[model samples]
Target: MDAETLPPHVVRTAPGQYEATLPGGTLRMSMRQEELPLPEICDFALRHNARRRFLFVSRVLGRHMPTRPAAMQDVASRLADKISIDPADGPVLFVGMAETATTLAQTVYAAWCRRGGQGLYIESTRRPTGGPIAFEFVESHSHAMAHLVHLPSPEDDPENLFTTARRVVVVDDEATTGRTALGLVASYAAWRGIAPESLRRELAVLARWMTDAQSTESEFTAFHSLVEGSFEFVETGVFAEAPPAVPHPDRAGLARRGTRHGLSHPQPLPWQLDVSPGHRILVIGTGEYGYQPLLLAADLEARGAIAWVQATTRSPVLPGGAIGHVRSFPALSGERHTEFLYNVPEDHGYDRVLLCCEDVLPPLEHPIHHISRLEVLPLPGTLTS
Candidate 1:
């Protein structure tokens, strides 16, 4: 149906006995095989940015649930197809949404580099480390206001990366109404002092299951028309919520308590203020467990702690710094492995440090150097409260 003719909500079902409510009629989703002709560039973006959650049921990656790396690659490949850039022209900056999309965006960077492009990746964050912020924006739909993005060198020429790019591709897992992408693009455009038309921009997602064609059209018309550009989508997968699974040891305890706490009880931890009228708190999230920290941070803020939030991820940065988000972090296994280095920034420090993990213990070797205080909260299965 057209965008103007669609309803406010639509629903869909899946083979896993799950259902998804969309803007149109409900669609039945299953582990069925579907293929389409895609360019090598697009494939690269998809492979790099794809998440385990997006894999086909029969695929090898889906066999035991794909690694975060594999899923991230898939997402990146898909994004590459949406926007093309010329690296020799200038550097690209990639900005990823906090929490879920951090790694996916990083994957986009990786693909761009492989294509001989130079780029930088940054995600909106809430953890405040008492540093000067390069820029700040608002996420209208997010629970928190004030998203902070720190640029490496403010003195650098913006034209090379910000203005010279052929196009900017905003990456996300899904685009419901397209409001988030519009917000991001507008923020960047306003800050860069470049007309939105000066930069060709697009959006890439693994799924595009909006309520109707009209909804999609209206969203694009609202944003793209303002920016004076066009937009496109790749795999238009339907959205279907999975059925709840039996809780594992790591989550059972927290799940039970969460239910008792009214799903909003576990408040965010307080931020240690080092300066008066303290700066905003920015919590840099880690991996799939990042949401827990996000919720905790939000709770802390609700309880009167001044804090903001963001996440680090495995997504690659591409030319113009476009990338999807991914789930990757340094495992505290003392192995000195690659996966262990992703999120452990060398000078990383905070006023108050809070860590959330499943059954894993905090890495003792790291020695909470950047943090003034450290609090560790094990998964719900470990404690009643």
Candidate 2:
């Protein structure tokens, strides 16, 4: 039976204590909300990280679980609608957190632009561009702690982007402590020599504070989310530190793709996808090179194909709860560490699977090769590896 079909049940992993029977381990999860149902958007999982034992795997994030690009787009559009920053206030700057939120940030930026709000867009990156760094921040609890914000190209921001922006919107999949967003604003504010109070802060997230501890939204000038919730995970056993998915991409081999540096606006790439109605397609992004593939999937979905977006990752999680399937593939950049792709079930009859990457890849050793037809597509602006 699929994990999703399994009822929320608990097991006693310790004496006189019970925990929710999730994928990685036991977790007792609860949620509080106003309008949108939490389960529809997210589910619980146990993480290999000790700093945060529980993980809120988003069903629509196009990360852990494969989701239709249309679904991802809708979530982003709704979140973008909640952002009401006026361009006249000063140029608005939208920042997507590294890794997971890259695509989300792009979508929200595009959606906001559609609403006639002009803004500069950028996403933090774990893989640095050899260019000058704008600033740095940390996601303290994350498996990969360091994140770098790079300088915007001259065309994207003719003037100083950070100093000129009156409002800044940080987009993330979820916000628990909200420290990451707060730290981001702090870093940018300090680096640009502007008072933190002088710049308005905003966050666009799927849910805020997944635990009942306390709301961290107060740190920001405005908080926008589809739902508000809290959860509790009583860990009954210890899991080893999950291995990193793949070794870091070579800095010298870094390929400029998506909005890692900055984009004048969120524009669809020139590439076109041939899609047909009733055809199910899966678009897979190589680690960190996710946003462009999602754009491709979204475009294919618009043209009558059933397209789902998901990416390979370095963060590790056990197979249970929200994560039902796991496949390890060698890094395309020839990194030795094992990279993983999650949640493509065995019986999923996808007509084709597109593995989007920053550089052209040779034949990769992955379990999915036999399950479906696989193709590699280079992300636009990619440098040859």
Model 1 accuracy (lDDT, Cα): 0.38
Total clashes, candidate 1? 78
User: How accurate locally, in lDDT, is each candidate?
Assistant: 0.38, 0.74
Which candidate number has the best lDDT?
2
> Measured by TM-score, how close is model 2 to the native structure?
0.87
Which TM-score value belongs to model 1?
Answer: 0.42
RMSD of each: 18.6, 4.4
TM-score of every candidate? 0.42, 0.87
lDDT of 2 by residue, 1-385 (tens): 2345433653433332234566445565444553455556776677677677778788788888898887888888999888885656787888988777777778888888898888788888877667778898888888777888888778767665645888989999988778889899999999899887888899889888654445666668898888775546556665786644322333634546457778766756646877778788999877766777888887887888888998887677677777778776665655554567887767767898888767646454544464467877765554443
How big is the RMSD of model 1?
18.6
lDDT of 1 at 346: 37
lDDT of 1 by residue, 1-385 (tens): 2323222221222222222222222233322212211111111111222221222111111111122223334545545544455654344555555434544554555565566555544455433223444556665433333555544333333334444444555655445466666666666777777776555556655444333432534333222110111122234443344323211112111111121111101223333323323323344443323444444454555555555443333222211101122333343322221121122233334455455543345465554323445555566454321
lDDT of 2 at 50: 66
Candidate 1, position 367, lDDT: 44
